[model samples]
Target: MDRKSVVNQILSLLVSAAILAAGTFVFLTLIRKPEQEASANPKPKPPVVRTVPVLEHDGRLDIVVDGIVTPYREIEVAAEVAGKVVYKNEACNGGRFVTKGTLLIRIDPRDYELQAKRLTSQLEQAGANLNELDVEVKNTEELIKLAKDQLDIERKEVNRLAGLIQERIVTDSAMDKAKQAELTSRNSLVRLQNELQLMKTRKTRLRSAKELVATDLELAELSVARTEITAAVDGVVVQDLAEQDSYVQKGSPLFTLEDTSAVEVKCRLRMEELHWLWRQAGSQRSAQAVAADYQIPQTPVTVTYELTGQDGVRYEWQGVLSRYDGLGLDEVTRTVPCRVVVPDPRAVNLVGADAIARPSGAPPALVRGMFVSIQLHIDQPDPLFLVPEPAVQPGKAVWVVRDGVLALVKPLTLIELIERQTEAGDLESHWLVESKTSALTPGDRVVVPPFGVLSAGMAVEEDGTP
Candidate 1:
């Protein structure tokens, strides 16, 4: 009984072991089948990216620059003579216009007048003294002539007496006395000549004194005239330092006036922008002429500004490029300055005497210190392709989508870097490129976002219907 039972158990155990081993082999084969299938035929991975079309167009470029309006001419009026200010024109306060030669200030002229009068009196006295000396000289000259005649008479008498003594008709003592009288007469004549010479010298001194007094009188009169300071130019006073009873020293500033007939705007230009302008101007003028003096051409410019009172409305003015204003390149922005002038900012039209008319709905005056933007129109009419900066790859190449595939292209000419602002106030820089290659043209899509390590001939799926 024991041998039969052991044989049946052993057969059953062998069958169970065979079933378990077959199940394990089937599970392992099933797990390896997926791996082998994956290795044999793999699914392709398509690069997903958004695309934008390249824009090619010929458009007028308006070069824009930020600037501030300033006065065309500024002057500081100064006093030439020291005096107490007695009067000033109403316009001297500020923001008031005055014509040329209009009196702006008047200093006290009493002191100057009194000085002039004193000089005149001194001159008159000098002339009187000169006249008296002239009369005295004439009298002295007559006296000298009389003395000479008397001396001649005394000499004759002395000679006759000596002859008589020699002939024994007179004594030696008498001849000696006659000779002494002749000597005294000669001395008197010499004294008269010296007195005449002294009178002539006195007259010369008096005339010189008169001349000096006359010059002083002229200077005093000039001082009186200078007391009444007048406007040198037709302008509005922007500042006034002199007022009634305000004493000013010589050469002291009295007022600061600006000619408001014209306004100038000082603006800065980037180096690239300046280069573009100079090149355009050089095309018209030879390179030699342009290089000698790179003055900005006298091109028409439109200035736009919004006043604090005007609100959102923009006012525009026409101006011409006048000159370069800055000394050199700015330290911070590396920009040069250019000035543009707008004449007749007032737009005042004279109809008749005491009558004036102005342009209807004209904008406010372009006063000093007004911030503005200047637009210069360039006459370059060439078609250029614009590519977003995001699609621009290194080496002046761009990633373009052609037939839903990636293509790398290096443009022939990259014109400029155009910076514009988005609707959300975000600034965007775009590359203006020109591609002569037929591989790219207008309406060709370019991959923009989701851009990463990509190469030419790479396959990409256009995320949208674009």
Candidate 2:
């Protein structure tokens, strides 16, 4: 072929290659990038905002309290007499029952018996001595009477002899001798009387000594009797130390006595509860408060039981107020002691799980002896300012919307309750103050859905409209 025709073919091939490269570049740069961007990017979801309506009340306050129940008159019996334990009944440790005077234990009585016998012989000897002394006293009294009679006669004789001497009817020596004889006889009689009196006084002292010996014998008998241990009360023996051949010291714990036929629990009520109890007492109402202890009306601790419930909820039985610690205010929760006693759970039938309790406004169930748990209650009032927990933050802080702006603030008063009550003497009366103006004021429309970052005192679109 000719050289010019071959060159024309080459030029046509070059033009075709240029057009293909340019078309490929344009498609890759514009169409693929737009498609990739549209596929990767996505629209985000709206933010969720928790809010609550404002409430108000003539707010009397209430509070929750924690307490427990314990048996009354619990005592651990100790041995009062020291001895070797020899005998005991099966009712020793647990499930032991004995009536008054029931023998609980026995010590080796041989030694005490010997002592008692010896005391008995001594007492018999003392009694004989006392009887002999009584006879001697009677003899002494008779002798004193004789002596007085003899003295009177001798004095008369002496007087006659002196008169004879004065008249010179007899010799002076004879008269003198008669007088002297009378005097001597009188002196002898006086000495006999004194001896008798001394014997009588000695007999009285001997009788008194015998009486003392008798008392000693009685005491010895009593000591011997105490060696046989016996029960003083009728109850179940929760503890037992009396056993075979065990040495026990005086006043050592021997047994625990319990009467389970009736049981009681101890509890405390709030100040409000004490007020109710006092009123009950004043009214001369024999009506037993549900677990009433009349004595200790107020204490921070409470022991209580529910007396009634609805729909298969078992009611707690009523009981008289057995005791009270006294009424007073507590600094921590400001609640008074209210103790409601009922029949022991072991003694009575129980109702349901709903009967379990939590303190006012506390959602968590009660665990006995817990520390730092909330116990406050908002009393019954009209138009309550109830709000969800989420709306309020710690330190009672909440968000407010004003003029389309958000603000954070601490509330002046905030009352929370898991279960609210309106009793006759509750804090909440007819009047109530209700508001949500925490950090914001009225007439401020808040942005329902916040856009971007949220902060205190930040500007927001009114009704989210802009």
Candidate 3:
């Protein structure tokens, strides 16, 4: 209680109080220290990046194109001879089917028949004239023979008279009369010979006229045959402009027929797409190689169309690569036209070759102008890797995930780039990549797009991966 005792006690109490304060501060710091330490040096959360598997398989690329179907053959039948239509076939109307050589229309044959009859009559008359002239020629030759005989007899008599005169047994007047008789017979023979020659010339001219008339008759018969119009091909009548009792002129269009036994699809493809197709179809290893060889081989193709049924099934038909159509790059779309021919759409089966079971409902045939899809196989035996379009980055690089780490890799071989315009008109490009690098292999995961602030060697977590 004294001043010194009080100071020592106060100092002890102060020291004790300071120790207690220090102990309380240590207790509070220990209690709250965990949160601050955790805030300062925290374990990082891996960035969640979307990823897809890298699939390696046989490079059977399926190329799709939109096109319209058309008939393989279309023909326009024209009238070859002018006449009134006397008859028309039942199949001559629009939308009716007709076989080859089926009679479609018949023009009036009376006129052509009369013309042929007239020519035949002329030919008969010419022939008759020739026969009459030949007979006259024969008769005139007989008369000429008689006249020659008479001249010979008269000459002999003149010679006998001359002998008698030499013997002084006959008068000079008798000898002169015999010579005059021989001269008269000789002149009559010359006149008969001239008449026979004229008859022969007439006969020759008549025969020539007969030949000309016969040719005219043949032509008239041909015209009569042409009056019966017939179908030239097995097809469907798309348009029929001829009717019974209708007068038609030569070269007038009678009907338009569409050969529906087969159909053609007219489609367009890009240059790159064409290259892929050439690679599939040609014997060369690459499209460039095929082009260098200057040969475009015909390849197999498949055509499909979605039916109107409720099953959402597609019907397919087999076809072959027909021709390049050579419709060079379009100015508007920069695509080249191609043509495919399905030999017989009616022969197509309802179910596809790869189908496990038969399809339901009746199959529909390929109609003209029906919108269809075409599939062409562009498979290469070599292995190829498919990375989803989302996983592809700029510069033709891809974000590959290895052991949960992101890597940017550039493949060595880029076989092709398929670009398709979406319904919104935006071009979406998908790549077909090939690589010999051991770093990239099948079953590896690739980071998809929108990977927030991703870099090489960055740790990533695949969304939805167990």
TM per prediction: 0.57, 0.54, 0.68
| lDDT by residue for model 3 (1-466), tens | 6799999999999999999999999999998899899889968899898776776645477677888998898898899999999999998999998999998999999999999999989988888888788778888888988998999999999989988999999999888899999999999998998888887777778888889899999999999999998888888999999889999999999999998779999988888777766655554466454343333456677898876643545678899767876746789989887888999887655543344444555454787988988987666545677656766666677888788888888743555566645568787665666645435688888777775787899888889542
Encode model 1's per-residue lDDT on 366-460: one tens digit a residue.
88888988887665434567778887766777777787677887753665677766668788877766455335688888778666778888888
List the candidate numbers ranked by TM-score, top first: 3, 1, 2
Instruction: Kindly give the number of clashing pairs for every candidate.
Output: 0, 35, 0
- Indicate the TM-score of model 1: 0.57
lDDT (tens digit, per residue) of candidate 2 on 128-229 = 877877777677677768767876777787788778778888787876777777787777778777877787777678777777777777776776787777
Our model 2 lands, by Cα RMSD against the true structure, at 14.1
Best model per TM-score:
3
- Give the Cα-based TM-score of candidate 3 against the true structure: 0.68
Model 1, runs deviating above 4 Å: 1-63, 78-86, 138-193, 196-201, 241-254, 274-302, 306-326, 341-343, 347-361, 375-466
After the best TM-score superposition of candidate 1, give how far the Cα of residue 102 lies from its true spot, in angstroms.
2.7
